[model samples]
Target: MKTFIASSPHVARVNRVDSIMLQVLLALVPGILAMIWFFGWGLLINILLAATFAVAAECTVILARGRSPLPAIADLSAVVTAVLFAISVPPILPWWMTLLGMLFAIVLVKQLYGGMGYNPFNPAMAAYVFLLVSYPVAMTNWLTPTMLAEHHLSFTESLRIILDGSLPQGLSWDAVTSATPLDEMRGKLDRDLTMDEIRQSPLWGAFGGRGWEWIAGWFLLGGLYLLWKRIITWHIPASLLSSLLVCATLFWAIEPQTHPFPAFHLFSGAAILGAFFIATDPVTACTTTRGQIIFGASIGALVYVIRTWGGYPDAIAFSVLLLNIAAPMIDHYTQPRVFGHGGKRG
Candidate 1:
């Protein structure tokens, strides 16, 4: 008898990317509901528009590459990306603009970089920055919270406004929408208003603002669920929020009128969302625990610096993308000691 031996390749498996992405989508439910309660159906239309375009664009790009489109689109990554992009955008963006943003995210940002795991940047954030730079007026037209704003539009009217870029009588949605809390604060500071003066406005609420704080709270809940599920580590979130608090407190102590409160900075704009979701993106973020903390802290510090002195009122996208560039170096330097090995290098 002759014995023949051959080495077999090792294959390791876990849940598919689709399942993880689906889990993220599920976690967004509370935040989505809160947005609808405050912002109305405009966000719904934006989600649908961005999601549809994302899936279509991904499929189309995959097919162009002679790959299976179904598998790529089925992974639900496109869905998550679309939702993130949609939520980051102003509720009143014209349908065509929304579509263009989705296409840029799905094609240029994701596919052009060889798709999901290989992309160096968070696709939705990149798309958001693109839209913001190109369409500043449209991007900043955040709607007034339902509780505070006088008029609210129906779902049908929202759909019409999003698709056509105008309400009845040729007025643009921008005319009715309210300024974001960050915008309001920056503007008031420029006009030499103190923090007390800014807070006295109906625009600011306890902790954060009328709609902004609730949205941030809802997203924080979602992030906690993700933590409970073990989908993400706590290091990133802790570092990001802690950095923000320290920076905010230091500045507020120096001059109260020049800086907003720490709580307000923590809850306003995309601070919580970026810390919990966007900055934690495994592909674009650091892999090791220490590295993740450093990456997150870098993002938090940049966000504060930019918001205080840079051109934009909210700096989450810029911060995240900037840190994404340094993630590789962060991972290299912060590599943990190998288990059970002597406390020294090989």
Candidate 2:
């Protein structure tokens, strides 16, 4: 047996890619369950389809690149990306659209930029924006929550809707679908309705959208679990929520009749989910401590701005993608001082 001297520093691998990705998947479970509970089986079906296709895409792309597919696909990154993308899209989105988004996310966004760590943008969000922009109607065709819904599609029915294009014979689209809470609020406000008047709808919960806010709370639970496990830090989620709250509070204080309360901003849309899960993506978000705060704060502010006045309803995907593009510059400027160095980089 030939025993050779080892390298200078023996680095042990504690958080392997597969392990960390698995933790993320586990953390998403509660939220996924809550989504299915509220939104019906379409959400689950889409997630399954996306995850399967995403894995296949990863294998095909890796083989084409002359790399071993197992090493990449086994890491679960593609699955995570698919899950995130699936959750973001309309539950009953056509099957081909999901496949297209997966291909764009895995082959183009992730692999085209040299895969995983090398990709500057978050593949899930980039694919989401691509789908949202290219097929606006399909992307926005969300189902009313189960509690508010007159009809809830079964698993098989949801599968048929996705694979095919419509509801059953007499089931018109209006029987089940409606505008999202944010969209509803914007439309009403544009008509010059006061927040008090808007709150008259049963769709309004204690603060946020009726069922949607609880889904966000379930996501918050998962995020807190991740924080407890040390899978993610507090800087991003804390700063993101705080900044959004400040903005919402300031605006609401200025015009109580027009602006919604602060809790609305925190619980609405993807605020809680994006704060903990999406914005904390290690590859695309800022790395330094101070940079992370700035990155999260910027995203939160943009969410408020875009949701309030922009064309789109929810702004997580747009805001996250925008900040991801600027993450490198943020890290560069906010780097901490070296141990033995002087003041700061400046």
lDDT value, residue 198 of candidate 1: 85
* Candidate 1 residue pairs in backbone clash: none
lDDT of 1 by residue, 1-346 (tens): 9998767644554556877787788888899899989998999989999999999999899999998998888889999999999999988789998898989988998899999899999999999999999989889988889988767878987888898765856455554688899999988899999888888998778888888999999999999998988788999989998998899999999998889889999889999999888998888999998999899899989999999999999999999999989999999999988888766666
- Look at candidate 1 and tell me the lDDT of residue 215: 94
TM-score for each predicted model, relative to the true structure: 0.93, 0.96
Model 2 lDDT-worst window of ten: 337-346
Candidate 2 per-residue lDDT over residues 1-346, each given as its tens digit: 9998998668888788899899989999998999999899999999999999999998998898888999898899999999999998989999999999999999999999898899888899999999999999889888998998888889988999999986877888988888888989999999999999999998899979888888999999999998998989999999999999999999999999999999998887999989988999999999999999999999999999998989997899999999999999999999988787885566
RMSD score of candidate 1 (Å): 3.3
